[model samples]
Target: MPLLPGAEPYRHEGNEVGVLLCHGFTGSPQSMRPWGQYLAAQGLTVSVPLLPGHGTRWEDMQLTGWQDWYAEVDRKLTALTDRCERVFVCGLSMGGALALRLAAKHGEAVSGIAVVNPANKMHGIAVNALPVARHLIRTTKGVAGDIVKPGVKEVGYDRVPLHAADSLRRFLRLLDGELPQVTQPLLLMHSTVDHVVPPTDSARILGRVSSTDVREVLLEQSYHVATLDHDADRIFEESFAFFARLAPSVGKEGTATGG
Candidate 1:
């Protein structure tokens, strides 16, 4: 399938310290490209994979589910583990939940984690209705492009595929039980005024995760798509610092150096 412009996956090979970034549900890699490029510029190997059923038309997304999305990120994490001495995982929105799942499932293999405006559960009647609604509805209004910065657009489907969204809800339910398994350092940043996800979701995650080293930052100026908002540079720089502090022999510039 021909991907939308700016929605293609991205990869950079720079050092043994790797960062794997996952984009949100109904979102393309374009949402994460700048963050990945920033990390890559700092001499970190970075991978931002377009999640399955994303980066294309909404109809294509209805054919896939959360398992497909999780599998792709898991595969990329394995690839990073194979090549990098230390690997960190980060994501935005639903991608943040994927990063948490990786840390839970892989344990010590993940050096750290960082996420922006992650969603742990769907809000309101939507969550309770998706199980049945998928059979009746095809799509709904999209939850993308929630940036506060003017003229900045998130490249994503204009509609949310019902089936895929239901699968995401199920994935989060399963992940909730696994939160205690996330023991690596975690840096979670959320937009204080996010319209897509409630702030309580991040609070729930912070309370449940077992990581002793965790930091939560509130993005005062951005919205749900903080990765592409006013606080974007803050997210990129802070996440890099979080990863570097946890990894051994990280240089002053945030790249890994031989001990």
Candidate 2:
């Protein structure tokens, strides 16, 4: 499938500490490109893969589900692991769930993790209908481009696919059960007020995960898409510092060595 312009995946070559960046559900890699470019500019290897069923059209995403989306990130993580001595994973919203899953399954293989408004569980009475809705309704309102930054746009589908959403719940259920296994250093960045995902999602993760090294930062200016909003610079700088402290080390020619 041909991708929309600026929605294509991106990769930047750098040192041995590789970072795999995942975009949110219904959101394309375009939302993460600026951040990836910023990290890449620092001579750190970076990848932002376009998840399956996204970056094209809404119907295309309806045909794909969580597993298809996850398979793509897993493949990218595998590639990064092979090339770098240490790897870190970060994601937005649903992508955050995928990052945690990677850390849980890969264990010590993943050096650490950072997430922006990670969504693992849904709230409100609307979620009670997801199972039945998936069989009846095709889609509903979308949670995209929720940035407070005026004029900034996140290329994504305007409608949320119910079938795909059901898959998301299944993936989250599996992930929530395995959260205790995630013991890597974690940094959670979230907005103070979000219209889409509530703060409880992050609280759930913080409480469930067994990671000893964990910190949370509240984003005061940004909304759900904090990566492109006003606090974006903070996200970039903080996550870079987070990665720097854990990354093995950079040798001559910017290659990574023992930390």
Candidate 3:
């Protein structure tokens, strides 16, 4: 299939087990590319699809709705499943929310899920007031930490569209209701000092999901963007191990080589 507009599709051909990586809100595939590279090096097929309105100007993000974001990732997930024997999903921040939605709806198809700083809820009074004061508040983007790779920047839209924030709230509500349905193995990673998302968000997901094999990795050095922060290596290693354990094996020893 041809690549979608503003979407970058990375394909590594080797093992059948695949991992679909999703980046955070207002972030691009660059944020997740490091982890993708690590997993690919381990012989797993990895796909990091750029979310709609990302990897471009922030102004372009204003025109897109959450449905557009979800649709794009859904298409990528479908494509990965078609090519791999087993597929797992991992996401950061809002991307984590998207991953949860996918695992909830497609639990039978997904092998496992790994989430980093999943934004299950909006924290603090100012952010909580966004729904009512979103019109008055014109912008959502600001200079975040300088933890990105060289030449990569993370700037969001100048204004937080009231409609888009409203859509996100609705999606969270839907996800809250659907959490009990997710029974696949789930691995959640979050930082203790994440400024954008609260640790409670991870706790909520841990409490709600029906998955019996849920595990949480608390990152001490990173903030919200754990994928690019100090604990990034740990995230890659743990996620690789998680997926590898679930991958189908070919030998009598049951050791799968990739992903």
Q: TM-scores of all models?
A: 0.96, 0.95, 0.86
Which is superior by TM-score, 1 or 2?
A: 1
How far is 114's C-alpha from truth in model 1 (Å)? 0.5
Model 1, span 1-259: residue lDDT tens: 8999999999998788899999998999999999999988878889999988888799999999889999999999999999999999999999999999999999889989999988888887677999999999989999998888999999998999889989988999999999999999899999889999989999999999999999999999999999999999999899978876887554455453322
lDDT of 3 by residue, 12-55 (tens): 66477778988877677767888988888877778888877665
Candidate ranking under TM-score, highest first, comes to 1, 2, 3
Model 1, residue 185: C-alpha shift (Å): 0.5
lDDT of each: 0.91, 0.89, 0.77
lDDT of 2 by residue, 117-140 (tens): 999787668887999988899998
State the TM-score for model 3. Answer: 0.86
Query: What are the root-mean-square deviations of the candidates from the true structure over C-alphas?
Result: 2.2, 2.5, 4.0
Task: Point out where model 1 deviates above 4 Å.
Answer: 252-259
Off by over 4 Å in 2: 248-259
